[model samples]
Target chain A: MKTKFKKTLYSLSFFLLSICLFTVPTFASGLNWNGHFQTETRVNLDNSALTWQETNLTLQPEVVTNNTRFYGELCYRRSGLLSQNNSLLASTNSNPIELNEIYLDLYAYPWRRMDLRIGKQLIPWGTGYLLNPTSNLNPEDLRDVFDFGRYLGSNALKATTYLGEVTITGVFIPVFTPAALPHQQFQALFAPEMPSLPFTVNEQKIESILPAENLQESAAWGVKLEKHLLGCDFSVSYVDGRYSLPVPKITLTPVGEKVDLLCELIHPRRKIIGFDLAGAYGGLGFWSELAYFFPEEVKVTSDLTAIIGQHMEIVTLKDTPYAKYLIGMDYSADHLYFNGQYLHGFPQEQGKDKLGDYFLGRLEFTLNDGKIKIPFNACLEVRDFNKFQESFAYLFSPEVCFYPEMNTEITLSLRLIDGKSGTNLGKMKDWDEIGLKIKYSF
Target chain B: MMRKTCCILLLIICLTFPLCPVLKSQELTAKEILEKVNSLLNAPQDQKLTLKLVLIDKNGQEETRELIMMQKGKDLRMGKFLSPASQRGIGFLSLPNDVFYVYMPAFKKTQRIATRQKSGKFAGTDFSYQDLGTQQYDEKWSSRLVRAENEQYVLELQAAKGNDTGYSQLILWVSTENFYPLKIEFYDQHNKLCKVLTNHKIQKIAGYLVAQEMEMVDVIKNHKTKMFLEEVEFDTGLSDESFTERYLSR
Candidate 1:
């Protein structure tokens, strides 16, 4: 089955590439092509045993006719561990080539006020820079937490209409795709859980059941209305879809002096209502986004007779509703630019904490007509302030970029992390490292 | 005695009447001359043109770019890069009230340019966003004619209060025949000459007098950018719809 899927993907890629090269020039005068090639190498500061290298090449081509427009991108990436001595990280995929996006846009469709877009495309729907809680039309790509590049596009149909200063947009997605997760190798080495008891457990296994694409009821849809008024841009939207994160339905049983645990990953249905606003006053630019999510519940059962009880207890794991919001501001003066954001996540149910509230800031200074630049960035979690008396996790990244030519740049950076273990960013403290990258665009 | 007094008064009047024309010409103020210059420069309500820019470094290295631009009325303008393979599909749209937007082909995204970013260089050229569109002298600056000599008028313009600009003052040399600007010098906030722009060639096209070639030199950096108008058409029937965001990606 995997081989057949791979063959189909390869054939589709070739077909799209051929159309981009051959059909564009003959049909349109606005045909254009541009892309970039980059390479990066990273080394761990604490241990030389953990090192990685990656190389990427991308191609983007676009064409416009009188009323129809076509856009597409293709990427080839190769990454691997620098040292083979680490057996836990040796199972990762080292090479992959994929089609990032391909879409067709029809302008003034049926009228001059509406537009239609179909095929694989990204639908960005929020004002937050790093994390967009209101964006639910497409699945997120969480392979790298630090990088904010383009997310993987999904097959969708979108229609937009403009009425004076207001716009309305609608989207329909027929397929169900889950958000990509971090590499299993990295997770195994860094995400170890502490045991509460001193007993040895055996036969622990996890099984995930994703919603099949053939299920007609698994489709998602969303709508948004945007307007500019009182010198501010505002938007209100709602989405009914599946949650991007999986919920575990756990089962436990005790037999023959040993315990067996089973975890079945399931994606539950969810509904989100969101709002966003952005505006500028004087020298400061401000933006805010808020979203509220309602998720379905799951069932969990545990056998307690082996330790403290004589019966099996059945517990209900209810997915609680939560609200997430981010507020940010940006300012620039002379050659310095700065941006800061405050994020908060409040759950409707008490005693349940998802990702905690945090603050993020970025500062950049440019010199020599923007040929040389230095940037500093940091993020700090503000949860558990009174009890812990300190931040849960703190990350700092400082980088320098030099542009020798118009289309080329070289960058060097260092990533540092400090926190207590078992936390979101705290667990990755050992991954602190320095990196160098060079990219050329054409 | 009455006949002798009358003859002397008549002789005095005759001598003063011969100098009246010169005094009347000197009565022209700086603002009047600027108004005439503005009228001549903005004669067309709509226009379409192809522009070629050649940038030269201090060491004499040269790079060239070509673009097509269209303007409707005084506030709506759009430009698209046509040459230099890497930047060919980039587009810029300027609207009223200092609103601007840029379309990048590689990302298939059209993003609004912040008001504070107006002072940055445009497309790797020495020109800023404020320099590309139509110039409104009365809106931002006050002018005074310093002198008129050799059939040319030299004027000095100072920035109005509360106007955010990189330059504090500008000096212009305009031709008296057609009221066209021949040379201009820009002074930074520190009162230093930072850049100089000179018109090297002029031609009449579609019943409008136009500058065919011009050069902008950075005095401090010792670099220069030369612009040439390859083609121009006045009264091109352009409308507000042509400058909307819907057409930027196209």
Candidate 2:
């Protein structure tokens, strides 16, 4: 894996060098380079051990001509896997440098109001600040579990056309990529809690099944139509793709008094219909996002005693439609800013009958001419409204940021989470942590 | 002869009643003055300007920002930051009816700002969103002539009913020649002066009056922001499309 990564990096570097050499002759408005360097450290409150620490630098280079432009983002990382049993699996390609995004844009092509872009790019197709249910084209980036709203880019072709005040966007992606799971500790959160059985559990294993790249099903496409009216921005979209997260199919084998469970994780095919609106009235800014998902049926098979006696199957999921949405509002006055959102059903949740509700709020104060900022953020997840006290999970994080000079910032933050085990957030109750980050942009 | 005298007296009384108010006052009404100022401010169909903003702190330290501003009609305006790498690519669009939207380059997203947020500082500058917007004073403020001079008219403007603004009152010195404001004093709710704005180097550019240099001083904070016009163009025929979110994000 490391050798392959090095080869890819070398190829990319040579390609970028060639582009520079080619453009140096006809360069009028040449390439501009800028990005940032960041280092972050986090410590667990429960064990006082370093949970995460890394240093990375990103470089963004863009070349612009009159009608065409090229943009690229390259990141150099200095640290790899920390300590964990499955650290090798959790750490990414572990390359010294990775290409985050590269794309070429053609403006006013074919028509006066049309733009086309191709290559690895990010399509941020949602209006909500929280969980954007309308953003469905790209896979989720769970490298940092706390960075809740990040998405990975996709190599695709996109075209945008403006018809007066309306904009139409179409995208086609030929390949599918699964979500980047978090580190080993956080990756455990994706597993389902095992039910009590007569046999004592001994060992467990997970096997992930990804669709073959050559298959026709390993593709995604989406379209969006956006318009501004009534002093608001509105959009409707549709995506035909598969969910990036894997669902588990458990197979339990009993041996004497102990049992082993073989967990098979498979990506499910799904389609999404989404809509969103963003507008402000007077002193209040409001936004709403809605998405309905249609999924294919999936069954989990369990070996009761296939070698000794019998086989059984569980209908884990059936083809059903579920909805996810959020309504949010924000207001800023003087140096204070407040945002609140109520979300229904997280992206990982799939069942029509098993959706949860969450409330997210953030308050920030900027002082000393924006040299310092303090923000308090909170989230509450409720599995059952009737038993809110027993089936509720909550998290609180407060951060202080100081800007000592231009384009430089230092931030200190504390996060705490707690709840009963019934809620999803409760599974990570021991994740209380304190973190510090220093970032500088050029 | 007595009947002719009565008729003459009746006609004189009727004619003098209408002239009494005009004779007593030599100043234009607040509405009439505001209309004149609006007309002068919005004389051009569209305008494009390149400006450099210098911020001076109390400690004598200075920072600078560069931007391009576009305006169509009275209230449609868009501004994009061009320099100060941190603020570069940030843009805001203001349309009629107090609609506003801001684009953040890092997020690659556009957000609509609430009307009340107009009072907030823009991009860490001393100027608020309201100060940067191409505001129609006649639509937002109610005014009364405070003092008159040989070459200027002093007007006190109050926030109209149902209008929420950061300032309680503003004293404006309007030029008699072009009806353009030469200076303004901003007062807080306590009626204390907090900020002062002065325009200098007024020049006629392409048949329109333009201020070559402008400054806003926050007296309470002892800070100053000065803006210099690098390039100014009037009546450039900017379309409504220029004020949309597409261009703002671009």
- Tens-place lDDT per residue, model 1, B1-250, is 9999999999999998755534533776778878877777778888998999988878787778898988877788888987665577788988877667777765555655556665556776777666776666666788888887666788899988865556789899888777789998988878899889898777778888899998988888787889999999999788677887667867
Show model 1 residue runs off by greater than 4 Å: A1-21, A29-31, A85-95, A188-202, A253-259, A299-318, A345-352, B1-28, B81-90, B104-109, B231-233
Can you give the DockQ of every candidate in the order shown? 0.27, 0.54
Judging by DockQ against the true structure, name the best candidate. Answer: 2
Model 1 has fnat of 0.09
Worst 10 residues of 2 chain A by lDDT: A84-93
- Residue A107 error, candidate 2, Å: 2.0
CAPRI quality level assigned to candidate 2 from its DockQ score: medium
Model 2 error, position A349 (Å):
3.1
Query: lDDT scores for all predictions?
Result: 0.74, 0.81
RMSD, candidate 1, Å: 5.1
